[model samples]
Target: MSAVPQERRLVTAIPGPKSQELQARRTATVAGGVGSVLPVFTTRAGGGIVEDVDGNRLIDFGSGIAVTSVGASAEAVVRRASAQLQDFTHTCFMVTPYEGYVEVCEQLAELTPGDHAKKSALFNSGAEAVENAVKIARAYTRRQAVVVFDHGYHGRTNLTMALTAKNMPYKHGFGPFAPEIYRVPVAYGYRWPTGAENAGAEASAQAIDMINKQIGAENVAAIIIEPVLGEGGFIEPAKGFLPAISQFATDNGIVFVADEIQSGFCRTGQWFACEDEGVVPDLITTAKGIAGGLPLAAVTGRAEIMDAPHAGGLGGTYGGNPVACAAALGAIETMKELDLNGKAKRIEEVMKGRLAAMAEKHDVIGDIRGRGAMIAVELVESGTRDGAKTPDAAAAAALAKACHQEGLLVLTCGTYGNVLRFLPPLVIGEDLLNEGLDIIENAFAGI
Candidate 1:
């Protein structure tokens, strides 16, 4: 019951007839600002593949940017969500409250990193969770400055836009960002000015120095970082980097927040990516993989810090909708019963093995990084294999287009737009995963 029928059957052309017609309709109705990587429209999605309106089955390499880790149509999610739908939809937790909402918080408290006394507050999305975490941190420390890494992506909201690092599509033209936000260096191994071996210590030292000189530690409320950067590329922070930052935050009385929106819930072979380095943050923000594709997010933290905000200062109308809570419960149960963490680790072995063999032949692949199912390959100029790396954004785009044409869905990201990320569902079948990788290999060969 945990598995979906594993196959990559193409019924028509990549976009086919029906999808093309819908694409035309979408062009007229959808906002010009909103963008989709592929022009095709999805009708059904589950383990391994998403079926388009034209009946083309494309292998899924992007789980809605790491949302559906339990697969899109997981049986438990469907069952629990269906029962809740029949009972009652929205009573507003702030008005009457519900057991489902409390249960989700209980799960968050138990599942998030740190064995210390913990508490949680649910929200509707990752961005909301992040914003709330910041609120709690500032209130707890009675400080104004919030520090974030150079390549981290928080959200699209105005305050989060200020928190985010990128300037193109995410932050461009959206000005007057929130105040008291400062940018610092992240331990990106591939692009560090120093060599990869020195990335951790060097980056940490530089970050701490900046915090002390430019922004006093006493004025800082929190230090937020993504253990594995997502939209900025699937860059896993260099080993020892996170631990160093965590210690510095502790010494300065600054709340450390691990943004695990895209790296949590077994997506990285661990419940939380920070756990890999034993970097237990005072606060952890989660979404994306929390509720089996439903909208749900949470900020779990030490009880003392989380309680800093008054009752009326937190919560929203749809913070923990009963249906979403039901889906989250089902997703957690499915992750445990299916042992998704083990699956993610196994997938890392399979994918990294295949990608390494390919890298041996292809020089354009400048780097291979990330943990478990959440992985990426950085593409650079084909000839600069041993020289200064030059990003190959064109090659990344071309590879993704080639994969789409062959019924394999892939996504491109990174500050340089040179990273081809892979986020296959943990429940995907081995045959399907290898087949998808084969398509990627073939695309690279053609390139």
Candidate 2:
């Protein structure tokens, strides 16, 4: 039913001639700061394949950084979005509200974790949602300091940059960030000084101690974290870590916020990563996969917390645009009709099975982590294993290049830039999934 052929075929080299020309033009016109993972100019995409201008079809493992969980061109999404465009594109929800906006909020309330009375406010991007979440938390608690964890990435805005841990590309020179933001250690299993088994208890204790000693818990407004660290190597917090921190926030009267931008929807096995540990957050920020490929984000949580801010205090000219809201409803419909959650679980089984075998053969793969369709391999120096390995960033970069050359699109992330993450569409075919893994294995062999 898809127009694009769901197969990997190379008519020419990776970036073929047309893509090369486009890259040259992009270099001259686009901002130097705007970077790309792959240079191929896509002409069409659907299912598991991205077809470039030169007619080469590459197996897409990134899914536009986990945005297109229902496939880039899902039928329901196209139908709803096209219908919305035909009727009306924009009335600006704030100026003249439409049912689409309220419908999306209602769906988010039902879909996101918790059965309690909940509310939501849509935004244009993850950064905007995160900023607004902080605002609502501050207003509700009447506190200042916000707590974040090491290796956590919230967004690119000033307040988010202060919350982010990585410095090089994210925070390098982007200062002075917003104030009253505090950073503490997360239970990073592979890198924790203590063993992975002990990381949860030890790290949580340390974080609580620092918050109490340095910034009084009474002064903290929110404690935010990614249930599964996205750009931070797909690190799922060690067991008990999330529950402990969440309990601390509850005991201290601080709002517990879950930054589920990259890990929400069916990207993880569950609708939300926090559901894995049954850790219910007071506030949860969602984006990336909310609207198929459209730009939509939201902060959904307790009704009281979401309504803390005055009515006029929370709105944007383009937030919850009618067209985007329509697309979101379509996406949710597709997710339910197709049972994307089960598909994500299937992807996890296939990926972990193959990756675990590869790890047995290659010591560079120090750890294979993540859940469901969102997975990753942390590359480290050769001959190292367990918790004794050193990050090998060069290896990660080289391996990614190899995968690119072979028409298998992959991506790398992490504070050290040594992690190769995979986020294939939940609709990806099982054969294509294995083929992509084969390419990765071959790349490691070549390395």
Candidate 3:
């Protein structure tokens, strides 16, 4: 069936009777540090709705943190994974390689933006892909320094943590980060020192000037960035900023890496967000939505740079696990068959329409921004007229809690923790999608 029927039945309170009982058990058994954004527990999910253990069906706007883009329990994915399971689960690609791994790499080269000769290496997570990209860049350029933008999120590993801009949840107490990593300012027009009114070219030129002066282009091996800053708010770089950086990286020996973890696979109405500007990075790191929930990531780049790293240096024990590769094949097939890029464009239309209306009605909504389905609404304490003020984190947290109570799952992101990111499955039915958006509007109304 193209659309699954959804019924929002709340038999008990949000956590419901069964989930509360399990939550208590979970607290006793699970580590305390592992936190949850929503208190409700999910038992089943399809399309865009998550059925809680307590029988309350909540619309899922988070998409398992943007991992399950094809949707939870997609039929094709289940069938493909099931068939692959019958064949064999793992032989370790490094020890005994498989066609599934090779097939996935081939697909990556074909699908990722760029008409040039491209090569790919599969990994287990975004962090692994990013680390390998850096390794390859350094090996190819014979440079030690890597430059990342401010408010960019790479991953949780020691090296990626050093590359990440946030400190509290990601880097706190995890000290002694990797060396030779540098940070530069991002073209966040909302908070830019020069302001957004200036032309995109001017803003980009200024940012490039800062990078050239501070880091010295010759010493840098790579400049890594997210086309749309994922965790640090879904801030799209100013128009000219990405092209300028890409050109600079080319002019110098620096390899430009686009971290497409949260922005790829038709998430932004395109196969890759970098395609929006026709800016091709030397390397692209992708994960989250690549495998329809399977743990799979890839670093696709120019063949020369990718081949610079020795074969043994680019692989991992679990890299390109057969099962994950099979899942990716299914996911890619599903994306193409279902025309998810069109779905993402449709999602952008709905999101822009509703969020723009919401921004008008609500004073606290400072800005509504994003491209395609990867959209976010930045909440400010006062309103949009008072400039880009940080929204009250406590209030945003409370709003999220209220949405959870009202049978809707949402996630909060941003450097200041005030932006609400909407990552609904591209397959979400219009009814359910509108219902979830309505729930958000209601929560904001209550606020």
Candidate 4:
């Protein structure tokens, strides 16, 4: 069988005997804070399926939370990383530099938005990339306040948790977080009080006004936002919203940072989500999809702004690990060679069509949003569709459980915990894609 098989197989009940045993062991060893959606332990995963310890090959729609955009077992990524591994695992780039690090940075300069002289610093996680980006921004602008948006999620680190909006699972009890972070409204289409049509302009205007009156643009070091808010939900900002914000940052000399961690490397049918709106930021942070499932993150930006931090101010011991850098290079090559961007667009088309049909029959689907392979279906209470559009977290949860039982893997997100996000690998075949959608429809019907 290929990495992405053309069919789905069910060996036993979802969390079959083996997975159940693992689940018991995991419960005792894993921290209570750490969580997972389903209890099935995977033995191998590739293409668009995850084989559990019990031999259940589940159709994967999450793509390991959008990290494996080029496919977890992509041949190019495996080949490069394996070769690099045999040569030498870690000499530590900072201790003694490597060609892989320089080559990865070179590729980032060419691929990231804007033709301006750009430089990048690699990190091990999205949180690290985001934290470093803020550090760079503050150093460059010499300001204290950092601006984020409602329903925006940066990471779990102290500073990023301050940047993130949700308080329940992310920020609760993790208090005394990094300060100087301010939050504003995001152009969330469905939940916007006025209407979807006015959501963009209204949200943008309110955000800008709030910044001017509350935070003062002159004192803000950076205004970081996801072109498509990831964990907060796949909320694609309104049409003119991003441009307005970008222009404001330019005028104020603020370091505008686009957090493309979840939306880069052709995940949104473009090189980056900001490119969809032709809005280029002074800085861009990328991860998740960059290394074909390896832990690698980068903050790329205009050379002058990036150089704001003094010499010896950046880098970590494993910042640009040789294996991870090799994987990133391979991932980039795979994206270009296979044209995964076009595949993402096709995935979007297939998903939107099936989801629209699902919506016609199920009123719980209050909204269908997102771009390319990063699509989501917002669930709401059935009868409340004409009124407040109350969130149906229960329904979303039930549907997810139902899908898991049926050998399909789907993940839920959103501020209200009602959005079922679909992040299939770019390499997923049409048959597997449709099978997953069909499973979703059955799940909804079951609910």
Candidate 5:
């Protein structure tokens, strides 16, 4: 049904001549700090493939960093968005509320992890949603300190930069970050100081102790975390970690927020990753996969908490543009009609199976964890026989580069830069998925 061919095809080299020219032009105009994973310039994309200007079709695995769960050119999303565009493009929701915006909020209420009366406010990016969620929590709790975890990534804004843990590209030289933000260790199963079996209880106890003794739980506004760490590598916390932390927040009257920006909207085999452990949050921030590649984000939460901020105090000029809202509605339709959550589960099954096989053959893959299409493989020094497990960032970089050259797009992430994260579109064909895995297998064999 899609115009773009679903199969990967190579008429020329991966970054063909046209892409090289475009890259040169991009370098000249675009900011140097804005990095790219693959150099090819896409002419069209749909289903499992991104067709470049050079007529080469590359299998897409990144999903524009987990934004295109329904595929880039989803039928319903395009139709609804284009219809909204023809009627009128930008009547800011704050200026004049639209039905599309209200409808999107309604969907968020129904789909996100709870049955409680929920309310939502839309935004233009994940960072804005997170920032606003923090503002609302602070307003509700009347507290100052906010707690985050090691390797957690919130955003690029001043406050969020402080919430984030990585320093190199995210926080480097962007100092004098906001105060009252605290960091604690997460129950990282693979890297836990104690064994994985003890991670859930030990890390929770340590974090709770630090909050009480140091920050004082009474003074904390919110304890926000990604149910599954995204930019921090796809590290899902140990089995009981989320429930323990959520209980702590509830006991202390501190708001518990789930930064589900990258792990929500069917990317994690469920509407939200937090549902996996049944650990509902007081607030949840979402984006990335909500609107079929369009820029949209939301902060959805308990009605009482969401209402804490005086309404006029919580809106941006372009917060919920009508067109983006329409796209979101259409995206939600596609997700339900096709059962993208099930598709995500299937992706996880296939990916984990293949990755496990790869791990058996290649010792570099230290760990493979993540739910659904939001999967990652952490690379370690090849002969970590003693299990020092030193991160092999260079190998990850080389592997990604090799995949790129072979017309398969892959992304590397993690605090240590040693994670190969795969976020294939949920609508991707199983054949394309297996082909992409074959490419990864071949690439690893070469490595």
Candidate 6:
């Protein structure tokens, strides 16, 4: 028999009777710190729809925080992971290395931007990959300091927390952070320092100058950044900013690291966002969508820099789990067969058109910015001329809640919490995509 269709099919209230019961049980069993985006609990998911326990099928725009690019339970990924499971689960790659792990690393080296001979090391999460990138950079350069950008998010690990720019939520209670981490202003032209138009180059140059004076280029080991700041409101650096930073790093003997965890695997309409600016970073940290929902991250970089660390210094017990590697291999194959990069570009085209229209109609939408499929809409209080004004988080949340009630799942993000991020699967149908966009517009209209 054919599988049940996966689309919006609301039978009961969002939480319903069963989901409410489950939520109560979860409250009793699960940790109190655990949080959720939507009240409905997921029972099944495929393509663009997530079937909640209450039988309400909500359109998935979050994509598990941009993890499942090919969509949840993709056929090839399921097949490959299942087949691999039947063969062997874990031999602890460190204890007895396997071909799957090596193969994924090889693929990463070839696929990640940078024409230089590259090497890769797999890890369990984005945080792990980022940490390893720093280790490699320090090992190679023998420097003590690392520079990160304002509104940039690397990870939650101690070291990465120090590297991360946000203070509350991500690093509020968690302290004392790792040392030798410095933060500089990002190239956000929308909120330029001097209110200058097209200030990307100036912003980058000023940041480089600060680094040279305040944190001496010679003392800096690496300059880590996200090409399109993910949690920082999906902010894409100005055209020349990244390339200029890369050039500065090269001239100053500092390793340039691109954190592509949220932007890689065709999500940004490119293999890596660094490719958009033709900036070849020395190291690229990736995760989220790498393994089609599996927990796999990687740090791929120039071979010499990656190999600078001693042999035993770089691995984890579950770094490149066999199952996850198999899923990654399948995910990569799926991207190629489906041409997800092209799909992402198409998504951008559609989203840009729709959102541009929405911006024209709604004064609350202060800005709509992003590249390819990775897009966001920053909402401000009504009648705000300056984009620099803090976003209206309360209004954005109300809109998101309304969308959820109306059978769509959208997520809000940003430093100020006013941006709504769109990270739908590249495979979502045009009809469904339009449907979700309609929900967003309707929510904004209601607000």
lDDT of 6: 0.89
lDDT of 3 by residue, 174-287 (tens): 989999998877788777656765536676676578777887889999999999999999989888889988998999989999999999999999999999999988999999
- TM-score for every candidate vs. truth? 0.99, 0.99, 0.97, 0.98, 0.99, 0.98
- Tens digits of lDDT, candidate 6, 245-313: 999999999999999999999999999998997889999999999999999999999999999999899
lDDT of 5 at 31: 97
Give me the displacement of residue 286 in model 6, in angstroms. Answer: 0.6
Model 1: which residue pairs collide? Answer: none
Candidate 6 lowest-lDDT run of ten? 1-10
Candidate 3: residue 5 lDDT (0-100): 46
> The CA-based lDDT of model 5 is what?
0.93
Of the two candidates 3 and 6, the one with more favorable TM-score, higher being better, is 6
After best superposition, candidate 4 residue 396: deviation in angstroms? 0.5
Error of 4 at 247 (Å): 0.3
Backbone collisions counted per model: 0, 0, 0, 0, 0, 0
Residue pairs that clash (backbone atoms under 3 angstroms), model 2 = none
lDDT tens per residue, model 4, 117-222: 9999999999999999999999999999999999999999999999999998999998899888999998987788998789889999999999999999999999
lDDT (CA) for every model shown?
A: 0.92, 0.94, 0.87, 0.92, 0.93, 0.89
Where model 4 places Cα greater than 4 Å from the true spot, the runs are 1-4
Of the two candidates 3 and 4, the one with more favorable TM-score, higher being better, is: 4
lDDT by residue (tens digit), candidate 1, 1-447: 434346888888878999899989988999999999988898788988888888788889998889989899999999999999999999999899899999988988888888899989999999999999999999999999999998899999998999999898999998989999999998898888778889999999999999999999999999999999998999988899999999999999999999999999999999999999899999999999999999999999999999999888989999999999999999999999999999999999999999999999999998888899999999999888567899999999999999999988889999989999999999988998999999999999999
What is the alpha-carbon lDDT of model 2 when measured against the actual structure? 0.94
Clashes of 5: 0
What's the true lDDT of residue 423 in model 5?
97
Which residue ranges in model 6 land beyond 4 Å of their true spot? 1-4, 194-196, 386-388
